[model samples]
Target: MNGGAVLLPYRSNRPWLSGRDRKRIAQVLVLVLLVLVAAAVPQGPAWAGANLIANPGLERVDVGGFPVCWEKSGWGDQSFTFGLTGPGHTGANAMQITLATSPNGDRKAMMLENPSCAPNVTPGHQYDLSVWYTTTTANTVMTMFRHDVAQGWVYWTDLATLAVTPAWTQKTVRTPQVPADTDQIAWGVTIYGVGTLKTDDYAMEDVTAPATGTACSAGDACVKGVWQVLPFNSPVRGLHTVVLKNGNVLLVAGSGNDPDAFAAGTFTTAVYQPTTGTFINVPTPADLFCAGHVQLPDGRVLIMGGNKAYPAADGSHGYEGLKDSYVFDPATNSYSRVNDMTAGSWYPSATVLGNGDVISLGGLGEDSSGTVATQYFSQAQQRWLGLGEAHQTWNFWGLYPSMILMQDGRLFYTGSHVFGNGLPGTGSSIYDYDANTITPVSGLQNKDQRDQSMSVLLPPAQDQKVITMGGGNIDSNPDANRLTDVIDLKQANPTYTAGPLLPTGTLTGGIPQTTHQGKMYVSAVLLPDGKVFETGGGLHNRADPVYEASMYDPATNTFTAGMAVDPVPRTYHSSAFLLPDGRVMAVGDNPGNGSFDMRLSVYSPPYLFKGARPQILGLSSAEWAYGSTRVVTVDGPILKAELIRPEAVTHSSDPNQRFVDLPMSVSGNTIGLNLTSNPNIAPPGWYMLFVVGTNGVPSVAQWVHVG
Candidate 1:
């Protein structure tokens, strides 16, 4: 075997090793190497032939429900990507998806075309389908279909039917079966419905598989079952504020009156995954008001300033706030000191900036009375940098100064005041972060937007809308009292002609008017579908309606009747991530302890539609044989046409003709078409021909046959 020569025994009777034998051996070795390389590759968009289809090399029929995924680590799209761009559209702001029927009633789902996936899927082996989805009717069913050549029509051959839930859910579907004797595949999705399907995004990518599925199971058990809440024994006596991080929930609440001492505790924050639900104590350096807490992107929480318990003889402990900060890390299950703020304050507002830092607004500083001093934390510096002085000082209270970041990178601060010494008096100014300036804009809306209220940006449509929920004046000013006004902030944009008020109302009639100091109050969360959930505000009930929750749908611009769910009346609590699975965890917030109330609860959104739920039609077992025949007939007007193949095509006659629908549109254009074969679908000799037409009337059908 020296110098790459064959070392075989010298057998005079054997025929000489021919060139053909060497070529065959080489071919086998190359194939073995290819398989070895493929197996070593991680599953996802990065892998070759990592098309939307699963088992790409094997040429299997993926069918719907086979679990198409985008590796979580990939930078770009893996399956499919859609850009809804044209004249007048604001790039691609938000998207929704629905399964509906064409005017003639044919099943259809939305599709996104990616130039990258097209090369991998043209005329053959794998295809992609995806949507930006939200639900209005809870039980709406969305399905995926394929063009079957065997029968000369489109059918639900590879179905991925999804049920419409109140919140938005993103879906991806792929078909792996490829036709033999071809190198091209055509693909499209349709939502079978009569009503319009609203979607903000549509995409497709050449991906291997997702790292993990975001949901588990079906029905209410799927959403409601993933969470469990750990209740406080003393019930966070006067629970006031709540925040979530990692899988742990943190609360800065008060308990046991006297000097009105505040306490703290922890729960869970793991989003949609099933959590063990444990309750732990958050040790405070001193007994004080746990005014506000914000989570840093690196997972550390900045526990802000608050007043101490028992008026410190000279009224210092009871009235003054503490700037001593603590950072709680779930990784180690412990709290450590982080750098403290420049000023000791209470009733401060903290907003997470786009760069991952937090900008803390003013509140009552060391004087025990409120002051408008502003400071922001620079993660790099691990210290707070003063943002000069607030527009107003000692004017804003430590409660209900709303801070919400818009997608455009602007921090909108709506309510603060201008008392004689910078303590909260009464003012409504809109601040611009880029310029670090505040300009007062007044239709004189909710001056009481301070405590026991919440605000969220409606999924920024091209239109750009923002909503402000409940707040009241706690007798500070006679005109400012407990309110329930749904103010539309969209009208007050930097540049905007007055659009309609998009529906408006208040929660006045049936709720009560308690002491109104209104600590530990919360507002609502924006659902993927443009609806919002208003939860954990003050005790506003006909028969003590405090611990109640309701939903506000932007489509109709109205709030639903409230439901009792909060274990205790929560104010100053926090809820993040309306999980695609439809469950929201609310942590922090005590009854009014001004501190010690550390409690946690889970708020699940309502099911929008009710009926027999549609199941995720799993992948079918049938495979299409290659070199099979397909015959397509046009019964109506020609319009445009397209031919969709099951997977990528390797070789075939006129692969372009596969997309037959795009070119054939006339008053009565009828054509008979032939689909050839490809090696990708070896063993099998057929392909699924999916088609869509818009001859004036829309038509979608598929057929399966030999080419």
Candidate 2:
């Protein structure tokens, strides 16, 4: 609100006013008060805007269970109630929207909207939307949308992110110039996180402010970073995406997004060109919804396991694990069937071992008890090597457990997963792939976080830290947990302690009065600069409510807002990874009632917005040994050099994507970089080589194999 809060006088004896009288007086008083107090209104335009809402108060209840003159849609989850009995911010009645149980592991179940009757507005006018609200639980966000007849109701902006506070505070949402192509303007509000929120008075009108100042124009905001959406569309929804060694993107979504294609196991694949906005069709052998993927030492991608079929009668899928596997040959942009696993697997986690084989673990198996049997694909023999059965008691690591190979050749579990269909496997664990045994890791404060929580092998893999962020319960009334914890797996007693708070995104054009949205399903891609670009996640109530990407800085242990915003809403089953050119490709947005987004978006980081991107002039070899120093040349001043393990992501968790900082000494355009012999840090496979400049810019990646 431009003016200070007005404490409406309490008349005690004669406090009850007719609904009509109450709205009229409130509008008049507020307009007069704003004109007197707002000294910053722009000078060019005369203040002539009026309250466009039909009713500002909730005193008049309609037969349709909404306030008079207002219309609403969605599940029966809203009400206009009166006074202390109602939980309003003022007088007799206030509007309340409730969060209901969700329909699936990755679907939004609530949609309570209240819209104005298409208010008339002027062209080139700016407006402010204000409301007084308080909530019972944290991170309950209010959203607004603009109804474009052609595009339907598109998200216009977010107003505020409220926490669990008792006081009624006023929040404002200021929108840019109103579109001149629209016939009328309408706004609506809804709650995304958990809990209920009460609202009383509301207002929407034009205000004035000075436009002159030290303003930021084009080329200014790119000093740090920026995001620009490309002009082309990805042919297939990027349910599964990987950056190929050839600087192209390999996208996989087996199942042409037919309503029943996922259950029936459809195969649809393509290769996306980052340089040109075009897609080349590639075919897959089977649907890879719950499959595991890893880049091979020979620069191929091993795609293991996926959906077989789930009978439609049961309503909820039992996740029929598949015994089939395939290897994607980037050389031909095609897939080849490989040896099947010892047992059928769905949603398995795969990681490349020190010797070039892949250790595959967890996920629903043929018998569906978390598949006690484990297996590894021998790249040397082109056959499946059975590892016997894994930890029997801890088989419920759920799907895609945070399994990564350690420096000691042991597998460490971060106790996070894509699904929590059963009792969650709590705490971190160390598994000896040889002994087929498990040892509980101590000091982890956040256990039972197996439901879509994200765990990553932190930057400069040598650090040996696994950071896990945001997850929630599988139970009906689920809410996302904003817990960011890190554990030093190298420690004698590796335990997860608190790390930096996960970065929070603001509601579009809104204030920071509340924490916006939950943190489940946040996807991270390790950039060449050693920072993690994270975005897309579920809300507290299972809704995917975020579009703004954030970059995680390891040096300062904080996050800076992504310079660009992606328009797509990528929720559960979505994937993001850094392209060889330093751009980010985001895909997959599964909303569970059989809705899958086949559309994908790419994010050109701020570096792309600057001058011509730096170039990796040359490298001695594409392959390097465990411990060796190599000479590389760049076209620009080299600030740092890093090796990022190429990642294959599914269900928001990528077993790869670790950052290994190369010890570097620069000499003009030439640089010498050192590689560590520790397989636990660098692993044995191909990585994306990047050279960062002092200007915070990065060179396009080149393929570098570490063994």
Candidate 3:
């Protein structure tokens, strides 16, 4: 076919052509038509995936002159204007939002609040969200909302904080798994400060797919784990979270960081049953808001010191502590009064001795000054010891100092504190209570900035090693540091040595930060798998929630970075503890804006999603004594066994929580686990016993009393 002319059949016209010629001419014409069509069609980016957003380019508008499938949304007292701007990143129109005066709240241009406009999401699947924006404010964050079948539309989480960009920039972030029962989701970029923000294209794509096959592998839920936001919020602010011996969680608020509640004497406490997902309110006798708590030998919680008074509004005075003490019997779910301490304590550190006595130190006294007296709670008498009975240290330790018990009955201060500049001297010391002496241990890096740092007793407690990681001086510093320090207390003179730098991960700013990006208020949970699961923290005091998580293998002394991140801002006043089911429960986040997040989230580790968890068939005895070996029957061969102390955590200062490895020899389904000879290694109290199968999956813990 020449000059786009069709080939005619052999007939009375031009020259006759063969059948092969006609077929070849027809094929040539078809190829030419395809070329024209291909040239006329538009081409997309090579890496473009299926975008789940509707009206992604803002090219379509509704009758009100607003972008279709989108609406202007905000809260608090903010004067703002929202409309279609010009020169979008991909189209002719872009959404523009301006804040004239934002004294409180925030504003955002988000997807419409209807089912037709919101993007549908699958439970337990993560999505990558991106948006092109240019903003004048540094206080912008990516926000999202989910539609729940039972609860309707609710705020999900602040995905990430966005950095200031004068020029249009495309920021991409991965959201934690879409919570269960969530049918759809809406998201947008938010401006909490006075600024002008312009946005163009928006995109969201599911990145996590459902697992395939029976075997577990990388990139699957079985390897990366998953996080789920509980449908119901905690009735009380979980300022104090303790994993009780009965497998229920005791959540203590005691004024719950609310100045008004403190003024009204509205103390609160609740017992949460993880199995039933229910809460039973307990009558609180005193203001235990910043109190010291630990599990007694008999499984009762000994709570001491608390909020006597809130700080003065004009800075003339500060928070005052109370000397009242009480004990909560888990069986009765009631608190009974105990003898008052010698001095008031607002944020004391409670360490249960091997003999069952409790020593509480460091906290603001009633007068708002450092409390110098060391208060001792006598388990035998169930009261605070008289001044003459207990020796005084005559030293003022900082608030919430991590005072872990050493094997020799001395206490090791790991230089971790909260809400202050830290103590004087080296910030870490060994206190011999009987001798009334303090020996300073050196080599802790940035001791003053260790506030809200987490000090964890390395798993297999016989190792006698402690790791302090990630801290910042919330009172004076603007950034936290990714520092990990390990100390071998068994040394002649134990001193902290630099360990591996915390592995890098994406920060809340939707950027992959360097390893130098650290965090404060970090929760380091001791896992039954003999690893430390570090998650939930903030870059600043109570703002800039960081989105980094990892599993620290004590055996290798290395961190497996990029674990699943919790979708909540677990900042100051947050706490996390291991549940009996090999999961971690995280709660509470009192941010700088004076708001308390009561939502709770649970994280199931990779081991749980792994095939068939080991099962504990029976134990020779639930009560274990020092220097003893017990026989445990399991459904399958176990590679290891552990005894994890029940958690009595508050302000991330639970020196009581430790993982004690039980040396085991497996023969078929029966295992012999030799308990430690030293009571100091595994303190005399209730513990959760877990057995790990050869497949690395741990069984549901069984409550065992170790003495």
Find the candidate with the highest TM-score and give its number. Answer: 3
Which candidate ranks first by lDDT, i.e. highest? 3
Question: Residue-wise lDDT of candidate 3 within 357-469, one digit each (tens)?
Answer: 99999899999999989899887888898778889977888899999999888999999988868788887889999999999999899888888999988886766889998
TM-score of each: 0.46, 0.65, 0.69
- Error in Å for residue 581 of model 1: 5.4
Runs in model 3 lying further than 4 Å from the true structure: 1-214, 217-219
Candidate 2, run of 10 with poorest lDDT: 105-114
What digit string (tens of lDDT, one per residue) describes model 2 on residues 1-707? Answer: 52212312311112467777766666665565455334322233234455555455555443234554344334433332222235466677677655544232111111222222345454445566666777775535444455555655555433334446578876554443444443345554454444566676766676423332322244644644444445566677677778777777788777633537765556788888777767899867787766788888888888888777653566555657787889888889988887788877788888888888887777777655566566778878977875443332335556787787787888888777766542334477888877767888765544654477777887767667777777765564355656677787767878777776655554434323145335677787888766777777765434544555677765456677644656676776777788887878777777756566666667766666555567888898888876565779888655567898777887777877798867553455776676765577777777888887655578878888788
The deviation in Å at residue 635 for candidate 3 is 0.9
* Order of quality (lDDT): 3, 2, 1
Clashes of each: 152, 12, 0
Identify the superior model by TM-score, candidate 2 or candidate 3: 3
The regions of model 1 sitting more than 4 angstroms off are 1-245, 254-274, 308-318, 386-400, 416-426, 444-450, 460-464, 476-522, 539-548, 562-581, 585-601, 608-707
Q: lDDT score, residue 525, model 1? A: 54
What tens digits encode model 1's per-residue C-alpha lDDT throughout 142-166? 3333333353222232223344544
lDDT of 1: 0.38
lDDT of each: 0.38, 0.65, 0.82
Candidate 2 regions off by >4 Å?
1-220, 256-259, 262-265, 311-317, 387-394, 421-425, 443-446, 506-513, 540-542, 561-563, 609-612
